[model samples]
Target: MAGGLVKYRHLSRDSAHRQALLRNLVTSLVKHESIHTTWPKAKEAQRLAEKLITLAKRNNETSRRRATGILYTPHDLLPKLFGELRKRYLERPGGYTRVLRTEPKSTYDQGASAILEFVDGPKDLRFAMTAAAVARDRALGRKSNELTLKNRSKVLRYRDNGEKAFDDMVKRIGKLDLAGVNKGGADKSGEAVA
Candidate 1:
């Protein structure tokens, strides 16, 4: 009735409930950048977030207090948010928030759900650094595997040559002939036959 369709009273019908809902929505938006809720709540959250961003862009004491009062964020974080983030988005106009529709909930009045989130800045440098570290580790692992294989092959070659050396020694020692007679057969010195 107030803003078309059914508005989410969230049980209570007082100003406290509205303020509490707004604070909860803002906190969730800041922490996760997205939240799923009923359509009206999502729309309300989007409107609130846009206003907060506008105030953040202003970067003044009055604006900070006003935004903090509405969103219930910590006063300490306001300076950082305004000083750093505000300057970054000075060129941009509005549309600081986005809403997306999600699956409908089966229970709790079967309300259709949607997600609200803030549009953040570009990709962080740490992500690229982490990727580089992973690639370096993978390369090192491959090199270590290759080195292990080479060492194993060298050990196997040594073992094979050692076996061949033992076989050569046995051949040089020759076989004993116990069947021969002891009375100097053919050669008196008992030398082997040519």
Candidate 2:
């Protein structure tokens, strides 16, 4: 007897329905780098997309096979995703996607609507970490002025000369002694400092 048994099912049960959903979701994600959807589907797709990215990160034959199996996409596209895209995100440890809510269409479905998207690369991580550090410092009642100044200079340098410039700025800032500076331009040694 099938007593107390329950069969699990999906919202889109048919093959055509499922395939359409997957294709459209994947295409939208690739083209726009984000998409808005119902909370349940968005969460599921986010898991799938991250898995694909992890496969891409591996960049090997096995990973290619795995991605092909999971995504059911053309093998040719794997190289671009795994080679160029993977390299771009090499330094990031995960949480590559972000979800931000938007206004709902109806009160009945007024659950959290959100946009899920990829965060470009490790550069975003640096910016996020810097922001977090500044916030933490402020919360702890410690001086974050030095970090703020250093991050400002780094941002300016990056805007001027790109990632290499930012790297150089970080190195230079790391070597500095920041205790001497006050709210004014004068150093502890009573000298005008840049």
Clashes of each: 0, 0
For residues 1-194, write the lDDT of model 2, one tens digit per residue: 65566342244557677656755565566545668876656666676678778888877889888767654454655666777668756766777666655677468968767666766533434444455555445434487777675864543432323456444544444334344544455776888877
Q: List the lowest-lDDT window of 10 residues for candidate 1.
A: 122-131
- Sequence-dependent TM-score of model 2: 0.51
In lDDT terms, how accurate is model 2? 0.60
Q: Which stretches of candidate 1 lie over 4 Å from their true place?
A: 1-12, 106-108, 120-194
Best by the lDDT measure: 2
Q: Write the per-residue lDDT of candidate 1 for residues 25-61, one digit (tens) a residue.
A: 8767755556778877888777777877788887778
Winner by TM-score: 1
Q: What's the TM-score of every candidate structure?
A: 0.51, 0.51
Supply candidate 2's per-residue lDDT for 33. Answer: 64
